[model samples]
Target: MHTPYFSDRPAAARSAAYRTLWRWHFYAALFVMPFLTVLAVTGTLYCFQPQIDPLLYPGRLLVAPATTPRLSEDDLLARAEAAVPPGSRPAAAAVGSDPERSAEFVFRYPDGRQHSVYLNPYTGEMLGTLSVEQRFMQRVRMIHRKLLLGKPGELLMELAACWTLVMVGTGIALWWPRGALTWRGTLWPRLDWRGRAFWKSVHAVMGIWLAAGAVAFILTGLPWSGSWGEQFKSLATRANLGSPPGVWGGSTRQSTIPGRQLARPANHAQHGDAVAGGRGMDGMPPMVMDDLPLPSTPWAVGATTVPGSGPAGGSAAALPLDRILDIVRANGIPRGYDVAFPSTPSGVYTVSYFPPDPKREHVLHIDQYSGEVLEEIGYDDYGAVSRLVSYGTSLHMGRYFGLANQLVCALISLGLAGMAITGFVMWWKRRPQKALGAPARLPTPVTMRRWKIGLAALGMVFPLMGGTMLLVWALDSLALKRRAMR
Candidate 1:
């Protein structure tokens, strides 16, 4: 018959197993503590992604459709330029999958500069912009992610990731069964603080209590790998609960640019245009016919991905924005859809649907040349991998639970920060004199004796101690240059 096992007393002289585990746990604990500190802070701040985004962006991120008719992309671009300071340009627009969140215009300014007033996508109204730096949570996240140290800070954090795994391994080992008849020393926290046994037990027991969920959270934080994590993402996607990746949008769909061409270049640009000469070998006329107002030497407009939106079988006809937008709307496409006007004869007018839930993206490529619908695919249309990727994106950002989820992750980070502080205090009280890793100071005899076994018991469990061991070894062998010079 099977029974639940918990113990402190080593079984029948099998203290060896307990000893091995004890060593492993100590090694893992040392590095993991600091890593968890960073993870906790960053994770907590990231939890509020949804709330913070709306607050930071205000009416721009979410705004109901205009009472007036939606302005054309050209009109919106003109408005954005007129509204922002000179030399400013539109970076990208948000295509609302939700009508209530509809605002197509998004303008990004020069790097390092802040925008206080943003134009509304749906109505071309000037929506207010606020400073993200002023928010408390935002400031906290900045510290957690970068230690307020910028690039160097991020590098330090990346180096800390490996230590977290080590902690998990050693923690499990230390938490393993110690004895058959006794367990009070393992499961519950001991209040007998005067006893060394009590506090050690508290740290171990509390760690184990949170281990399962804590481990899961750690695994969840990493999107690229962890057991059958991909399968779970797949399941989420099959249910149509897909999220996009952080820092990258789900797809590379183009939004409507003004199609305003700058002046032709000084040299071969005009020659090339002269050769194409208002008509191509195919049917369409020159994209820039009159070559108005001495076009600025072919500066790049927002790049249109050519040959990307061409019809699956053949090219579609060239059409006006009015016709293309009308076809898109009539096809049951929402106002939030990305409308890409064709740049070349072969290029088609394309529309991509990327919802807050990326799974809702409905991609359609229409032949702009012919105004013919080329291809249409919805959330159900994606392959297994695509769907999995979307959901994983959302879960990584805690979009799965919305505000409640973000809040929980944020709190966990704060708890981790607290753990770091307490852990450092505990460490401080026990710091050895004559340097941390030096051999224990002998009494008058300078004896080789001094309780080596007990000291080994403590040091072997902490890998940070192992690192200290290496450092000592370096000095002992004169491998350290300072030692060598001496």
Candidate 2:
């Protein structure tokens, strides 16, 4: 009963399990480190966009305070249109409440690019023109989302995000104290430790502190991913947890033209007004609601159909910009909102009010000819899931609580970057010369039924990650077999 084999079985199993988990943790860190660092840096830069933009383009975005009443919306629009190149169409105008800020008018160039023409609201003088892609923060956002490589880049980022979850999970397990915890090596790093030991302690302590924030950042960001975001949106909408029934009201009319055809290229830039060119249909432009006019919309009503304008009764001409402004004020849609002009005779004027607070977000579709508010969706009408997402989006962008929110998000981002650097240093110091220096594979792999089941469950939740895992497993099995033969 007390044989040596029986006595050592539990210890051997524990050792095998630890090695296997350590190997997996190493692999996950290797894959996600570079991506996580890039995301962290870019995300930090974007979080401070409010402060950075003014310093970057003062002449274009800033203006001297004026005692005189600002020029009317129509006058500003006219000046903006006159300042643009020939063949440019005025798409939207953003009215800001700030007394010292310039007005912004978005225009669609003949070549399909969207540009913003800035004007001094007080004098109706052209401040400057900047393309959507030209803005520094927008560029950082694109890189953060897509790595500037388009679809492939987006997929890579998604894959990295998925693996980051795994990395964090395994990192926690590795950092977990086995024996009684001590302050020096558990909650805080032992600064007196030498070489790899010191670096490892730093990495472990930082990771433990960052664990909650890292998870939150990753989950909040998933809603914006190309693949997972779309699927989740479709699922939430179907469950009535997105837009909810009848939010579109009695209007069942769909745009004959697809939103994509009317929308700018997939890479459309969002600036002061954050106007996305049109609702897109494939590659063609269509007059749809989602991603039309405003580049960003509340997640819940993103796919809600835009109501079309009826035929004009007396005058076929659309309502004047001043009239729309009057309606906006009358409806109490805060002072700073973007007005998207109807692209076609049947198109409706779209007013989107996206403030820093999610509760005040609003979108109104007004009949271009009759000036009737065809459909209005506000934060109060959003489904539970949509409301949650709206709040999360605000937090992710560091806009929820102003400066405090920005500082918290910045710290998290920079913390992640620091963890990556520390991890790399730890690996480099101990890595064997002239080798990949990965953790050695177990000589006799232990049967880890529970671990396998947990990993399988995770893979199911993220299909892309699951598929990659299968491929890696197959390749590893082949390598093991070859090594055994040798």
Candidate 3:
């Protein structure tokens, strides 16, 4: 098999390899194309969520242009406390940076559900209440990340993404320059040709051109996958290759006294006397804010436990929210930043800033009692992996360079969709009506061995993809053997 089969029969060996690569590529696209289409469509929309949300939810987002000084924080809180549902309590107040934007107060129910109440800061009028998941952008994000199926959906998307990398690799190999360069038909499609031949050339040419962008999109997004992402993040942290040393003083772990768990004034639960505090409005458990289920966040500081309040009542002893706002602005944290008010008397106020330029990302935890900056993290403070993720995510969302970034991403998405459609058409035209249209397996031991080695290598890098490939291989072998027996 090794002697004359490959040496003297080099032409035959190359032909077999081409067929094998084509078969694998076809199988990969069968699984990957649907996901690629969904990701592209959803990602493009999410990239423009900033613009879309304002237009879609103007009543809940925008306010009458501010003509006077906004109401004081205490006054706004008092109004919000009065506005929440009888059984719900305010968890956090999101102070909007724009004068024309409404302030959002998140209310948590005893069952762990949360909703946002938007109020006009200047007029002290309630704008609207929206469940976080019901928001359009959040829905788009859920479909993009988990298909709304949580962990299982996340794993499926991750597998598709990993296989997409394989598809790109096999695609490049299939169309790679074999001999002399032919600019007319190879680099550029032969528009003069007619029918399937013309479409084939076009598909191959465009696929080759977009392969790099497709790979970038896949790799950048992998850091967000549930299993692989968590494992990779842990590995980076353990190796001291994560965010800059002592950035959060190793406070990335889940907070013991979560800020989101703090109860509102109407249903206040003293920091130390939870048992003594009354139960939720009716017979339900006390309401506490749950950690946000957001898909991605730029801030490297995960969760910094808010310290307990000072000697005085949790109210008067805590620093004013307006003062913390001033500190953030003074530190050059610009507008559009969000200030999450402390959930508990001891909980620190969190000022999070995600700007157009990724490098300017920052999250500051301010002590609620003394008003001291407890934990401050910025883009510059991120470790190698975190920095990569920040930049990748920013670029992926097309927030890096404004319109140009959006345009480039949009074109890539459109191009990807076009390729998927064109590839399917080409396959349909070539396939027999009664057959599955899969490429016939190479009968030679040498060729099969080569294919197995290639698959094994890819499997090592992306275990999920490898698992799927093995499943497909097993099914194919069984079918083929059964057919032979018949």
Candidate 4:
């Protein structure tokens, strides 16, 4: 007389439950493997940007350390403008604090293209011209974001990110150690084993070890996605998560210069009245520069209407760029900050400061006419969400703790690639000839109920993933019904 608990479900039923989970895991991996590989490679390379960038553009990015007084902002701007193609004008400048770094001047032409001219501030000598698109890291970034396909590619990546979470969840379920499996096989791969068993152990172990970082990579990157990202941003903004409306004072809704336009250094401003505004790489909204022919600042400056510099040449004849620079220096803006000159008579001069340590980020919009500080915002001014995202983004970019940050992130990326490879190898070897190699479907009624509940919960948490699963289920159901009729 066997006990009821001992015989419940039998051995075959337990095995079938595992197979069902394995099938879903395989499907999730099928959707996410390639993307994981791409992201791994790109992310690893991006992690080393601080080191790789100088190597890639040595002549343009690096300059010999000099002790002589640096050239004036006006003189350097003049030299940088002369280095660009005819008809191009300076839009913004990136002032490098280190004596060995070159000051970079950004120019925009009529065709909406942006380019950068590097100049040695000490000698007023032009370094080189580089298109933002032509930069190696920019290319890598584009590939990482959407395979360089723009919106459609972005959607694919976002979908992959979502499914990757599913893959990890299902993978964890399969990896749960039970029965005979102990630390030896669970925590570390059984290298002594051969063929499919060895691959399986390796894949499982890798997935377990790297799942946390992979999830972090996906979560941090989601803020940059197009659809869900934008919606989430809207919600976060509405809730005042981290972004306060007036922290960086300026009109948030004004149409500003498109990033693409700023990419071409040779393109002239086609629309004279177009406001130059948009969020920079740092994810902060920019202040717009009203009709003034001001140089381009970081995307953080966005679109801002520089208030009138007191009635042109009136009693408040706007102080020259020199005076504005002096005021900024006196007011505690460190040496690396940039001063964007005003183009129109009424346009105000804007000073921006962003250091590697994001906690020091600040920006000041000064009225060119009266030399008054219109608005100033610092890291402390950011709301809860903004502060969190700001520091997280910086860390994600490997800019926080220097080389150690880059190395850790790079290792995580490499680990992700290893898992992808191991997983693919396991599947390829186990798959039957000319078949998908999916585990046979033999889910019992109880098991099906469990799956339904689990899926419902997942759907509620991630609508995109749930919606895709539902669509697939519907398609499969329709196909099966049609086959029965036939």
Best by TM-score: 2
Cα lDDT of candidate 1 equals 0.46
Candidate lDDT values, in order? 0.46, 0.78, 0.70, 0.69
C-alpha lDDT of candidate 3 relative to the true structure:
0.70
TM-score, candidate number 2: 0.90
Q: Residues 1-486, candidate 2, lDDT per residue (tens digit)?
A: 232322345776666766777777888888899999999999999999989989999999999998999888888888887888899888888878888899998898878788988999989888898888767887999999999999999998999998888888778777777645454458899898999999999999999999999999988888778887777766665576766455333234222221122333222221222235343335443234565756567766666666667777765799889999888888988787888877766677888888889999988888877789887888877877888888889999999999999999999999999999998999899899898777767676588776688789979988888998798778767876897899
lDDT tens digits, residue span 222-331, model 4: 76677676555545655656444542223322222333122211111223323243322332222344333333222222333333344545354556566777788878
Using lDDT as the measure, name the better of candidate 1 and candidate 3.
3
Candidate 4 — worst ten consecutive residues by lDDT sum? 260-269
Put down candidate 3 lDDT per residue, 1-486, tens digits, no spaces: 123223445676667777778888988999989988888898889888878989999999898886689888777877877887676655556655677788877777556576788888888898888887678888999999988899998999999899987788788777765544354557798788887888888889999889889989887888778767755655665576665564223432222221223233332222322211324253332322123222234634442222333344534666666787777877778767666655555455666777767788887767776776766778777788888878887888898999889888888988998899988888888888898798876665344565577779978867777888889878878987987799
lDDT comparison, 2 vs 3, better candidate: 2
- Give the runs in model 1 whose Cα sits over 4 Å from its true position: 1-29, 54-74, 85-87, 97-104, 108-117, 120-123, 128-159, 180-202, 224-390, 434-486
Q: Residue-wise lDDT of candidate 1 within 227-312, one digit each (tens)?
A: 12333343434354432221011233211122323332121112112211223223222232112111111111111121233333
Off by over 4 Å in 4: 1-13, 245-324, 337-352, 446-462, 476-486
Highest lDDT model number: 2
